[model samples]
Target chain A: MSEFIKPTPMPRKYFTPTVIFLSVIALVGIIFVFARLIFGIGTVTNLSNQYPWGIWIGIDVAAGVALAAGGFTTAALGHIMHKEEYHLITRPALLTAMLGYTFVAMSVAIDLGRYYYIWHPLIMWNGTSVLFEVGICVMIYLTVLYIEFLPIVTERFIGRVNLPGLLKKYNNSVDKFLRALDRGLDKTMFIFIIAGVVLSCLHQSSLGTLMVIAGPKMHPLWQTPILPLLFLLSAISVGLPMVIFESVLTSRSFDLKPETPILAGLGRMIAPILFIYLSFKIGDMVIRQTFVYLTEFNTASVMFVIELVLGIIVPLRLFMSPQIQRSPLGLSIASFLVIFGVFLNRLNNFIVAYTPPYQFTPYFPSVGEIFVTAGFIAIEVLLFRAFVMIFPIVSVPQIPAVHKTKFSIRGAK
Target chain B: MANQSRRNFLKTSALIGAGLTGVSSKPAKAAPNNILDENRMGVLVDTTVCIGCRKCEWACKTAHNLSAQSIESYNDRSVFKNMRRPDDKTLTVVNEYAAKGDDQFPVDVKVQCMHCDKPACVSACIVGAFSKEKNGSVIWNGDRCIGCRYCMVACPFQVPAFEYGKAIQPEVRKCDFCFDRTKDGKLPACVEICPMEVLTYGRREELIDLAHQKISLYPDRYVNNVYGEHEVGGTSWLYLAGRDFHELQFPKLGTNPAPGVSEAIQHGIFAYFVPPIALYALFGGVMWLNKNRKQDEHKEANHE
Candidate 1:
């Protein structure tokens, strides 16, 4: 059982045309990032006082963080909730989260005007500010994520601590050190797993609390007292779908056998979570009497309708079917809808439904801003591919004789 | 060592529990000391008395040490053709709304920061970059500002303007109510320079009373309501407009304090650390329940 669960790096051609295309996009994004840093936020973004947050925030940071919920959800299920079958998906989810959060941090650094003073939130305590809570939690959770990844790092390097020339003598010490570190981490991992779940809850809800501060500035159709709960619930609902989406996509990309039964189990988990989210969403609107605004036939109303109908309702109905849950294509389609829905919900909260009073013009992301956002996602993909090639992230079901020879040649070199 | 560490953890947790209770018990005061002022200063702008002259705009720029076109250049009535807002370059702007039904002189409303009793910008700034001064001016600290512009989003009146043009040291520019001058026991730049004495600068409490008296004295001239007296839980700047304020582009907001709903929910869940601890405990219980099941799975798989 232990041997079967042990992950090994995937075997695939490293430099595919798709990888090259993504690299070009990432390179272009890097150029604009330099422009943003050297010039100003205004130079690269269409963000004004009227629209301080554009897609970089709406898509890259807010939506990025929400989509990364798979990390905690999978960890909680596999390690804490004792769902051992879900263990196979955990490492990949963690890798995605670590990379996703790193980029989220980088995006924030680019977005901030005083990017150098990004650490001020740590020292400056403003408990009342939701952003303060979010900043602190994200900072701490990122550290926890790195700590969680240490065992994986140890696993990769423990026995293969070879060094060239004069450094060869130090290999034995390095190997021993890694083994000790791995042993220590294995015993104490549960504490960090618990903290990760707690920290995730804090920030997910606080992101919603951030929009609540906008108050009358946000359209009534989206505003509610229970926004934090809705945000948390929605994050949880989208968690398993994101895991399934990544797993199915990876399976197709690497030409590995798809874990159909496990993915189908994940599909079942999505329904009840989505149902809870919808109930609260509808209940909040009904109680606040904000449902009337849905009839206004404005941008906010139309956006709300589309967000629920396409993002949640249709996906929820689809996921309930046994046939849809069992097929990789059906699971991917349903999960994509969930991802799109949550992304739209975040976009609605930050940009679509927000109207600054006495504004002359509406805001749209500039070419540079769009490029930078695309670049962040592209970099995440490139990094994910690079790391999986170097480390044992994705499980290799079978190691062919040819592959073993190739691995030994590479190791010897 | 283990016993001492356990005791330490328990002690710290108790202290945190006490502190959280303190925060939730007085949710209104969770806003910070800058929000509370017994005798904060204010301004009452009688728009009915204001002529279309733009001298106050020039004075504000000059007093703030911002570059201004000559005072005479501001007198060009053509500038009022388009309604303008207080931008990064300009701290105050006068917009002329044509009076309803046969009036020659346009209603000129001077616009700037309302400096709410509970300033949302102050509350929203994550790094504590903004604060409501004791003199009732919401001021920005450039060094502390990360330029998240959460303040700009949070402001109901949309007063905070960012320096989008500058590549370096861009600031959130807004009317500071001439806080520096007021600290020196002098009037605000615009209030001191008003030729018609249309701007009355005084304590917030006295100004509200004065606003009501003027509204009653000239019942035919001004609206009965003092625009900013109770809006967004009152503001330092009170307004007496001849027409509805919405006509002048002032956002129609409820009397609720801007941070009320956000703070309530944020404080409610975090209060006494009840929800977080309970959530942790719940997860721990789940871990416990599934512990045996996981071991059983491992054993069964090994047997296979």
Candidate 2:
């Protein structure tokens, strides 16, 4: 059996050509973001009254939230299910979720016409609104994610709070503070872990409910009463795949051996979840008699077919094969397909499936809108790289005790 | 040791569950000002009597303090060559549809917010920035709005319009039923300005009776159906049209209120917050059970 590896900060050089490219893209995106803030959403986005939402909502907010599901799913698997072997991937998943939610919140702020008044939902309650439920849940879940991440911070800094120069005198006091925080968090963590999972389930489904109010305006192929249930299931199904995708990519980027055993185990579990999601999606369509729409060759039907066959069915089949799950390249392909499917599903639900009455022109994202979304993605990638470099996130082969001691001494210095 | 920990976990979870239930059990707060007052007013739009004059458009803009061209400019009928919708700049628009069979004159339809009894905007607003006033006007509160534009998504008639160009303090624009004028005991601007008497302002209940009475009295002149009477669980604005409503660009909608399905799902998911709390407790139980099982297996291995 392969021995377990301890998570350690990657020792690779930080600024590669790819990192520099991503930074440039992120900078361009920031320029557009500022332009949007100054000139209003109308100038930067193709959003009009007929299509008030664009890629900012479909890609940045919806897909961002869906992709972040890896965090809670892993927490549930490793901690809640007591699957000790799976713990190796949990920290990276947590970090991804923390960053994912932070961006989602930021995207929402930028997308809102009155970004400054984003806090109104907290004080002014609307129990009837689906968006209100989603907003409040996301706010609470983001806080929960930050709280769950506290232990990792404490673990890194508890005994290593070496402040520089004038602040060096306070290092001992800071270390003591971190130690106390670590102890307090250790006892209360299980509650938060469970809460995190519960909150994720609530908001993920409620996100589907966001579009439900666009009755008759939405294309029949996507709209159904069980939309919330479908949203929750898809989110659950995508969770492990997202973890696998990020894990494989991280392993490649950092030149570390992939955790094939754990990833294969996760891949095996994904088949059943994807099957459940597929069955419900097809079942809902059939029950609603929406399949008749497939006979008509339109944008909605073609997009629906692509979303189902490519995103869900293909990935489902790929993951079921043990050979595919075990191979690094195969696992990456399968996981990417699943991620692509969820991403496409979000875009389809928010953009393609919506058909407003009196729409003179269909909404297409402006150049600025595309750049802003790309920038957010680039920033996310840059943050992920920076985090893994500084923190003990990715697990690598365990070093011998003597070598480990030497490494620690060098790290401290 | 495992059993002791399990018992302690269960006890703590039960306490948490009880506290959560207490939080959810407080009296349900209904959305403010949704009582549907018995004496609420309405407008009865008699489309058959309306000539293709765009006077209501000019008056609406003037009433809302929007920039309006000379009333003489309204006489230009070429604007109706293309179908138009109520938009940010114009709260109401008049469209002329060709007469169906033998009628000598074309039918003119004035479009604006239908102001449903159970308004979707009132239910869908994230901050409850919209309310159904006692006077039967479904109005938006700009002071409370965060400009999410969800109201635009929820309005069944697609009535609410947003000021997309203005970066600072952009507002949602829609027909407010002339709430400001109504409050001062004045008729709505369009109602006051209609030279044709095509629009009648009165109590909603009385208007519904008057609409049904008009259709019954002039069976040949008007369609048997009264638009908005039962559509979307009934709107405050009733209409009597010569042709089918669909011909006049009115969307065919079910009688169930626009917000019915979404609100039902929202309430069901969050009903008493019981489902989420139950899910939390169930997860706790499973975690405890799994931990105990692992602990037992480890002890057995140690014994070997």
Candidate 3:
């Protein structure tokens, strides 16, 4: 248990190459998006006033926010509820949340008309606006998330052993310092854990409630007063499944053991929460009778029905089956489906369902926009790999390296 | 030190519990609704008197120093070629709708900003860029606009247009109901420029009465309905489409105040102290449960 992590350090040569690669991708993305700004959406992308918001709005921000809810959800289920089973996976979930949120800032860079002027909202604050609330909460939550995930990075730094001669050349202070920092992380873990849960709850719901101010402009099929409630609930339902999917994929690709015990409990948890979310959403729609809008078979209503079926009913049913939950393939399929559902629900609200009778031209992301979005994902994956490689992301450590590396060395000899 | 503090915390737990109870049960007053102006100035457009000529639009542009959208000339045969709208550049436009009956030519339906009483655009604006003035106009000050285009998303009328091209000067452009004149007790340029006396600008109550009186006097010419009286939380601008408004692309917007739903529900649940207080207790309770359970686990491990 003490030797939870081993020092590998991916040969320092890969560091600069990786950094250079990332910087180049970011630079290209910046240049292309800047060209769009210089020329306009017409020059780069197919966005019009009709389709004012597009993939940049839906996928990058909304879905991204929902996905990042993992930070709070994992903390609440693992630490707060004292679910010892999920304790092993908590660090990775926190890491994902941090990366997901940082990407939100990246997503904002792609979406805003004047990325330079984002400071205006802060320099000249408006407390009344929902965006103001969202902006403030997300900003604060960013710090909270860093507080939550920083320990994982620090822990990895602390737990690393077998330091080579160069690292030890600076004397024993660096080693002692890292050990002290590791102890400090454990002591303050309780505070960061609480802060993570509270802040996440605030911003996850803020994202949904932010849209409530849209009034009639937001198509009736998706519009509701209790938007924050629906948004937060949907985020929680999606967060668990997201962790499940990531866990299984890593296991299969790396040829690790199945995380069945943890994954099964998670699969069972998702269906009920999803069922509740659907019940509330439908009940709210019916109680308010916004369902009346369904008679008019416009784009918004049709998409709403499709989202309800695909994102909710189908995935919910599949997740409930014990056989399905037990099988890795079935669990992966369900997990993927759950993510898709969350993605589609957000798309329906942000893009497909939003109508401005004044002038609506449906916006699809420009090629530059798509690359930027992809760039954010790539960075997230890169960060995950780096952190997991350095630290013990998986609570349950295994002997994969000793088995595989010894075989490779034998083959070489 | 930790043991002493823990003992102290436990001893005062009853007092803290009582204090928390008192702290809750109180209604929270969120920031005031700056968007709601006690008196918002508006124009009640009587659709019946509107003769299909877009003279008011021409006068509006000339007064505001604007450009032509589609109509290059007053009598340009394509005057109604495409249904023109008030967009980023143009503040006023008149759309023509033909009647189902024997009336010749088209009836002019002027389109401008509705300037709602409870303006969603104002609340949606994060920088206080938008303000519903006491004189009944929703004004936009671009000094603080971050240009997230959220105001574009929030407006019920979908009135605010983002100057997307002018990245440097990306402001929300909408009809302010000419607030520049209202502060001086002068009518807006469009209201003053109406040659046929079609648009009347006055207090909302008087305007409603005038619309009703006209409908009563000549029921045949009007639809006997004031369009904006209760539509979407009652806009300051009213309309009188002589025929059924649907014929003129006036959507079947209900009289219910839809914007209020979000504000009301959010305030109802959270504006009071019930949720946060309850949430804190729930979190504390869960934490307490975990602590006890952990102690039991330690005991079991030691015994084993």
Q: Which candidate is the best by DockQ?
A: 2
> Judged by TM-score, which candidate is best?
2
- TM-score (C-alpha) between model 1 and the true structure: 0.93
Ten residues in a row with the worst lDDT in model 2 chain B? Answer: B24-33
Off by over 4 Å in 1: A164-166, A399-413, B1-35, B296-304
Q: Once superposed on the true structure, which residue ranges of model 3 sit more than 4 Å away at CA?
A: A1-30, A37-45, A120-128, A158-185, A252-255, A281-302, A359-368, A390-413, B1-40, B52-55, B62-79, B272-274
DockQ of each: 0.50, 0.52, 0.29
Candidate 3 lDDT for residue A407: 16
Candidates 2 and 3, the one with greater TM-score: 2
Per model, state how many residue pairs clash.
Answer: 0, 0, 7
Q: TM-score for each prediction?
A: 0.93, 0.94, 0.83
Q: What are the per-residue Cα lDDT tens digits for candidate 2 across B182-232?
A: 989999999999999999999999999999999899998898988988998
Off by over 4 Å in 2: A1-4, A400-413, B1-30
DockQ of 2: 0.52
Could you give the CAPRI-style class of model 3? acceptable
Task: State which candidate, 1 or 3, has the greater lDDT.
Answer: 1
